[model samples]
Target chain A: MNDTRLIRVVDDDPELRRSLGWMLGGAGLAAELYTSAEQFLERDDLHRSGCVLVDVRMPHMDGLELQRRIRRRGSQLPVVVMSGHADVPTAVHAMEEGALSFLEKPFTKDELLGVLGRALQRADELVQREAAHRADLARIADLTPRELEVMRLVVGGELTKRIAQQLGISERTVDKHRERILAKTGAESWAGLTLLAARLELVSGQPVEALATA
Target chain B: MSTGRDQRQTEPGSVERTPAFPSDAFDHLVSQIDDVFWLYDCQRERVDYVSPAYDRVWGRSAARLLADPLDGLNNAVVAEHREEVRRAFLAGLESGRFEAKYRIRLPDGSERWIHDRGFPIRDPQGRVVHFAGVARDFTERKLTQDRLRESEAFLRATLDALPAHIAIVDPQGVILAVNRSWRQFAECNGLAAPDHAVGLNYLKVCDDAVGPDAAVAREVARGMRGVLDGSQSELMVSYPCDSPDERRWFELRVARFETNRCPLLVAIHLDVTARRRAEEQAVRQQAELAHVARVATIGEMAAGIAHELNQPLSAIANYAEGCLDRVGDDRRPRSDLVDALVHIRNLAQSSGAIIRRLRSAARKSEPRRSSICLNAAVRETVELVRYELETDGVVLEMQLADHLPVVQGDAVQIQQVLLNLLLNAQSAVRHREQPRLTIATRSGKNDVRVSVVDNGPGFGAVAPDRMFESFYSSKPDGLGLGLAISRSIVEAHGGSIWAERVDGCSFFHFTVPYSRPDIASGPPPGVSETGRRLGPAQHKEATA
Candidate 1:
């Protein structure tokens, strides 16, 4: 269990939530508990990367509804649905809604931990990706207006002379701006800068569209 | 009514003719004809001519007929009718002709009715006048009319004695007659009494009816027309008529009545409000009974529902099993052990909470009626029995209809019956191979039905009806009140319950009437003489 990972348990049954939280905590996993899906959805801690263990059948907002709201908010937090009763259709629907796992009641210790492990692992991966993406976005944001224009043309496969002509700037100035972009973005070569520009979605106009289709 | 007075507008000149015969011949003619012919002279101020037939009309001889005045007719008039006759007679004297009817006592100790008439003739100078008159014996006709009227009144009284409203309508939908009950009902409802409603087209009256049942009244109007025209011979429609103050129900029936002149429609409207209320009250009472049963059944299976809840509780226990091992083996952090301890503590608290919730919910249950989904009820009942079924090695299947109409019921009572059936199914299949129980629900035209079928030993020799008797039970521990009370609950909802065998399996089925605004079904059978709603007896007639 990673201390960095937080597992949230949401259920209408106070006992089930507390017990699940306890079991996860005992497994060395830091856990947050919510008595209902709405409580979990309203928490400021939603920004933290975590896995949610939600009961499928609840009073107003159910596990599936919570999952939908999380997804619609673009949180990308993984969910593992559990039901006290044997409701297969609801489980399948929960899975279809991008739940990490669907577990029936009386699941073994291995099964609960295994589901939590996988869900938390995915959440961690998404968090890491988001962190890297955020850094890339900042690097792209740091680019000057002229440097961004130079990077776009470069990724478009245009010659440096052609970029200078399109921008009505001297070829030497275009070359200088390209160097600055490469430095700021940590690209080791011309091809690396082009890849980074595409990776960060910094390419604009024709080249970005071309790269999307490609 | 017809007056039968033929001389109200007769010509005075025609009535002033001389007697058809001379004095002796006229006396013989009047005596022979059963009528009195007489002549009066104004100048004498007394009766100058009289027929011997006065004995038949006035019950007195001709000489005594005028012994008091021009005639003793005024003295012979019935006491109550004396002034009326006197006024008409005095008016007749000035109008040249008159006709009046009155009752008189005859000389033979019999009463006779007479219609007297007189005509006046003017002299050539149009100053002096002569008068002649006839007294006809109308006793026989009057007696017959009186008997007819008495019999009609007796028939009306008979109809009024019934608790139902009755009316006789003509072919044109005109209300020719109505019983006392109809008038009372109309007055109670702030409507016109029969006297005012008669001769008013019944169809129009129904069309003009106001209330929630106005549509039903309109339908009745249509049905009445059908009955009047011979298009339909009989019609009966039951509907609800809720007033601003209270709820009411009635069955409107239209049937043909063959009159001597022509066929008519007989409408009978019965107030079934009490019966309807009794039925609802019975359902509520049954719900209370069921609530008790549910608590009792929960007592019987407290271990089972607890077992179901324990599934998750046990999982927490299982997951915490490794915490001790990992903490001692130095393979897991101390935090893991703490989390396990916390989880165990939480599971303990939760188990208590679940028990508390279930116990209070079961113990404090009161009859709560509402529109409920059968699927939800099935699910709750299944939850209550699932663990027991598992322990009994039985597999359960649910076949629930989708988008089934919601029916008004006491959900707790319905669940009790379901739980009872499922438990019975489990027991029935306890020894069978691959024991399976299927619970299904479906919507019928006017009701919702639930069926529990099991691949189990059938009712070996006991008749189905025998199973519902109090204290009748095939199971060693069953009190037999389950099925009896179940049947009562179902019937109290205006539905029928039944049990049968299919493919060597036992099937128990019941239906509950669903409330719909458009059309309502007749009340369930076994109504008492008072027409008060009664509990289901036999439930022998199955509507499936």
Candidate 2:
């Protein structure tokens, strides 16, 4: 699956891009190429698990601004920004926006390949986390009405007895509902479930009344 | 012709038209006197004693004057001065003293000026009994006085109206006089009453000049002292006298105003700030133009420079990756790794070359000229851009002449021109696998010409004559200063640069003449541009 995933190389120089693609291919990574950032955007490469490798000082639609646009669009695609000596400061500053790493040129092939690999790995991790969040959200929807009320209270940090009191149920009955919710959602711990909900932007760490509508 | 007694017959009550005495000696003295001596008796109120001198002084006979002294004298006095002479006479008549000056028309039809003085003779009771007076002709002294006064007035008017500030200082260093401009300058500088400066020592005034102009004042004082001591006949110096806000320059000139009686020094100041400012403005404008060209050229080539540097870097990366791959497999020969290492080394060297070129291009350095071969300059410039030319897949060819004579020029400036022309040729042929650029040098009897010829779309639809204008650009990103600065550099070397278009070829040609012994030994003052000798064809090349 890792071999099947692609790395997109965007550069102004055709020969350099081809050489980089050949280098990456030797590392058991697939390579897709674009001559410029505009080409990369037009080809819809941002929606893929493959990361974008950009040289910082391109002629048009240079890499730093492209990194900003990609992040603004909320794409999970990671970018590896590289630049020559004159453009190193801007490339390094672009790292703040979740660039995989800033690489300086005349980098060894291993360094380029390593940063590209990290960018792809970040994209893969993001995609998997997004799928997990969606699965967790689906599991929350599968809860019974009573279980939903109990889980919201539990994630809200109420004790089992307090949860039962809030739901007007017995303590044992609240415990039974918590067990069912945890089993169905596959949450390893109560705090873990809240953190997952926060990551999905579904609920606050301290769940409030708004969770009913969610 | 008629005298005292005969005249009294018309008057009577005149016992003394004279004194009824004929002393021959006294009569002779009175007749010869230049003054008109007269006596009038108050009691008689009519007759008067008269001297024969009346005819010589008033051009009238004593009988005519004595008959009607007031009317006769009024006629003798010029008509315009009649009332003035009469008023003075009447005033003295009461005071018992008389003094008056008046113009008279003589019987000879000529003009004469007269002076009249009279005294009253009083009795013991202090009452005037007789009046006596002398009237003298003073025309000669009056003429000389009038001429001197008119000449002085003319000199004053001419000096006051001049634009130059003029001051006359005495040998003792006191200012004797100053013209209008000198007083106006003092007034503008808060020295309100100019009379104070007139008597003030000029050397003392020079001591008060402060700040940037202190030196100017000191120098002026030295020169003025030289003029004062008679050691130097003249002082001529120009100096800046600036206020805090604006700059001003003045020329100070001092020369001896020699006279047989008393020698004086004449000092003059003329403002020359406008001409100085104009010259300084021209120098500043040329520097700004050169700076703009340098900055715009670099800005336009930024992307190209980045691309150039990146190629070597990417090649280095690709080579290392190939070496690693070969090592991991253990199937490739040791020679493969060595080849990869060598390629990496060359790529690194190319990147270094690009950086050095960019630094030199961006450095704002004054042109440093030295002895250089045209072929060597061409070779060094090509080396700087060789990687870019090769990467762009352009076929570069050169036919540098052998045994080429050295030219006097700035190596960096010449290299800059060659680089600009080469880049122009490179960009002209976009997407071509073989964009042929050829550089050739040929020696003539007195000069060497270098040409950059490219087989690209030759100056398409654009007139070749308009190629070197500062803001004319064919490329979208070009600032168009490249060719203009190139032409300026070439011309600064006393050569000529031009463009030609023929048969789908764009050629840029420039020539530098061999340094001549006469010209090289005698470079102009402030002319650091040493090696330039204008060829006969340079003017034609420019017009073309």
Using TM-score, give the best candidate's number: 1
Residues B159-237 of candidate 1 have per-residue lDDT tens digits of: 9899887878888778787787877765655555335366667776565655443555566777778877878777777
Check candidate 2 and list the clashing pairs. B493-B532, B494-B532
TM-score to native of every candidate shown: 0.51, 0.38
Worst lDDT 10-window in candidate 1 chain A: A205-214
Candidate 1, superposed: residue stretches over 4 Å from native = A1-214, B1-35, B46-98, B144-281, B316-380, B397-408, B440-450, B500-504, B512-544
Q: For each candidate, how many residue pairs have backbone atoms clashing (under 3 Å)? A: 4, 2
lDDT per residue as tens, model 2, B1-544: 1224232333333334445565676678788888777776666665377789887777777787678767456677889888887787678779766788889988788999888887766555656676666778779889988888888888888988887778898877677888988777666654535362677676665655444445555666777888878887787766554444676665568889877867898878777678666745653454456556665665766765676776877777786776676677666578767866787787788789778876775666554557889898888778766656755667889999999999876676777788888888888864554688999999988788999998888787788768888878998888788888787777767788998987778888989887653341223122242121111111111222
Expressed as tens digits, the lDDT of each residue in A80-104 for candidate 1 is: 9987666778888998989989987
Scanning candidate 2 chain A in windows of ten residues, the lowest lDDT window is: A204-213
lDDT of 2 by residue, A125-213 (tens): 88888788667667676677677667666666788878777778899988888788789888888888777566655445344334434
